[model samples]
Target: MTITTPNNSFNATLQDLIEYPANGINSTVLLKDNNSQYSLFCLAAGTNIDEHTSTRNAVITVIEGSGNLNLEGKDIALTPGVFIFMPANAPHAVQAKENLAFTLALSEHLPAKKGVSQKTIDIVKSTAPVIKQHGKTITTRMYEIMFDTHPEVKSQFDMAAQANGTQHAKLATAVYSYATHIDDLESLKAMVDKIAHRHVATHVLPEQYPIVGECLLKAIKDVLGDAATEEVMTAWAEAYQALAGVFINREQQIYQNAS
Candidate 1:
């Protein structure tokens, strides 16, 4: 639909935007800058785009299904994760073998940023099913362990909410949500920002993260018993710290703004 890049941080999962139209081909402009542009393209089976030339070097990244790229009279097969670097002024065309979808990146690409390790991402995704099934139980136990282990932190929570079990329920949902989205933190940016403001209001200190994190890991172990393997525990710990850093950094900014 409508595409506009506001002068703010932007984030999107490319796969989420891929959609074939009734017209056989659909394209969405994902991001645009003075020198860089990213677009997502979806094509129905047997669809073909006539050859076209770009003044800038464009990288074609196949995201789903199979396809072929005709680049300057040379044909190249396309598949999931395959990348073709087409030079500037080169004429190229795409022909979808099935319901193919791909991303087109144009610009001098910047170096990739570091994120949670692939192993951690895989572990989180694979373990999410099991954890979600027991999320409420684990979070319920987490608060008990936390308040008992450090009663001082209890006052930080709304006693009324805790009395009704809503506090535990919310945290439980958030915990599982974090696990599924650990690889795509940008998608959680708004939620993280809101939580950071709430944390700032409640005077949540950075040092308190370790206490909550420890109790959370222990709670998972206590609830799951033999099911919470060492590898699973390590992945959650890393994910928690990565998320904690997001909050801490945002809270610092909130504090700075207030002062």
Candidate 2:
């Protein structure tokens, strides 16, 4: 994974940390320490890390690829934009079944809430499509609605999309897998931070979040039809808050952890 920070600020860019080569099972960085008290990582495709435990609670986010995470004997397949948390000393391992990029945040010093457990809630399961045959049509409609209604954000995405190249397609596939398991709140937080950090570097405004959120909802409704209930929207809103909270916490932590 390539790391670029604009003017050496706290913002960091990760260009396909965990990646798969053409016809080669993907693999990338598993870990790195940047002297910021938090270690980062990018795991490559088809590479597997043996079961191990860390002294620091580690948060992992899939920024661009796909993989499977084995925590305490359970397997969780991960796609782009998915987040997973392993509390300190929790035994876990990761494997890239396909090309995948991942980020990990591990801090040696962090305030603790006593009695909290590190065991993660595993949510990767196979399910039938929400709609039998109309999934793509609905998804497209929602995407169109989102871009058409929010022209400014559309411009931002359009640029990214244009420059996305092959990387963009891979990222989209990964994100599809992630949206399936968005119920994990901590994981959501990690995904949010990863996105915010990336977008902030690209000059995306904070105000665009609601617009993005609304677009996502429209997509959900369009795809799920009547299945996209009010509760679903509420859940998504809470997830967004969880994601935003991580950013706020990180900004504060940067100041407090400054040299």
Candidate 3:
């Protein structure tokens, strides 16, 4: 198969580029860049690609084919027009029940800003004790401010939880945990994953992060008063953005896979 590097935009009919081998798969690299790649793949009937994992995220769009895609141990039927997304490192395999052709796109994962600075982590961690003590108060005030200013977001939350104070308690716990784990994020992986999934279920949009962050910072200042120094606020702001970036990226992947 030929691989070409284009210095300018190029277009072609994907179907015309397919080449099916009698007993194996054939592939052509259509385009490649610093962080992404696109390829076309064709497999003869009965051919298969063994289960494997990719370092980068990938999407497969069936152009003209019938197959079965085994993604993360779940089988999904593949036919013309079917699209599948696989997150980075998800185990997957493909078998061509009939002659199959598809386009594969791969993308590198862009992690949020190489993590918060050491000073930011130290500052945030130092405030963990105070955050733990006043966490619920700050989160409750945050929700009030947010609902008063952006009432549209109220629909995404559970009013019952809010009324009973469970929502505030949960946020407080999460914030305190985050502050304590600021330097060792891996310890908080389960919490992060759970929250990311919950965010997706609630259809949280990326744009709303800034609103929540602003309200949270203001609430902290209001509740902590003179204790919330400029340096502390700055560190928390940076830390919050870093945490938001992680959730945004994870939710985006979940959304793509659902689509």
Candidate 4:
């Protein structure tokens, strides 16, 4: 399912990079203009792209693969159809469990400046302090807490997880990532468009938005416990509403565009 728009410049071809040993990760740049960048990367089982940070926020979609994404400090399992937002200048890393392919899109419009890339071990030394102090890191913890406390929400993902399809995992990661990087309205819009398309594929009704909302609230409550202040919950809820609204609006636009 390749989507080429009149305004989109993304271009690339999937290739076999490894066979016997299934080692190393390779990337083929799809688009690299002044305003935006895109690429497809292939990785072999057990391969990794050690902890690294980017200057701009990146939206990553797992096209085909099994892997675990370490964002901030939490581990997120990723598979095909999953999307994850890597916030600007945030320390992140990847570990591939099987042959995998993924796509990444980054906006040049964000304000953050880039720092030098460090190896996986050296990464903590450079960015750990800031990540620990930053509020954004809490979201990763909240995700784990949410899943642990609200096992019912896990039911929403059972079918996919059982089949190793990572659609829900991707949506969750992308939503969290985009929420943390809301400085650019366009980035948010792109995130919405992606989510809308994903919903169409999964037959996800608009009503599922509330289910996700409740799961998020539960996660926050579990993570922060008594400290889950009203102000904090409200802010997160507002972000969720905005993101869901984008999904709904874009879904409508997609129908209109088709007609």
For lDDT, candidate 3 versus 4, the one ahead is: 3
Candidate 2 lDDT for residue 123: 16
For residue 165, model 4's alpha carbon misses the true position, in angstroms, by 54
lDDT of each: 0.79, 0.52, 0.88, 0.60
Candidate 4, TM-score vs. the true structure? Answer: 0.38
Off-target runs (Cα >4 Å) in candidate 1 are 1-114
Task: Write model 3 residue lDDT over 130-183, tens digit each, in one string.
Answer: 999999999999999999988999999999999999989989999999999988
Q: Candidate 1: lDDT of 1?
A: 55
Q: What is the C-alpha RMSD of each candidate to the true structure, in Å?
A: 19.8, 20.6, 16.7, 19.4
Alpha-carbon runs more than 4 Å astray in model 3: 1-110
lDDT of 4 at 31: 55
lDDT of 2 at 254: 49
- Tens-place lDDT digits, model 2, residues 1-259: 4343223445436672333455434333334343223334455456777766654567887776677899878888788788888875466887877666666776643332232122211211121244224444444555567668856655555555544344344334334544454444455556655655666555553334445556656776667666666755555444433343445345445434542
lDDT digits (tens) for residues 21-112 of candidate 4: 44786666665544566777778888978766664579988878688999999998898889999876577889889887888898754432
Better of 2 and 3 by TM-score: 3
Q: Compared with the true structure, what per-residue lDDT tens digits does model 1 show for residues 1-259?
A: 5265647677777778778876578888877754477888899988998775554578888999998999999999988999899876477888988899998888642222246778888887787877789988888898889899789998888999888989788777777778888888888888788788889999996547767877898998898788778998888777766666677667767876886
The C-alpha TM-scores of every prediction are 0.55, 0.37, 0.58, 0.38
Question: Which residue runs does candidate 2 get wrong by more than 4 Å?
Answer: 1-143, 158-194, 247-259
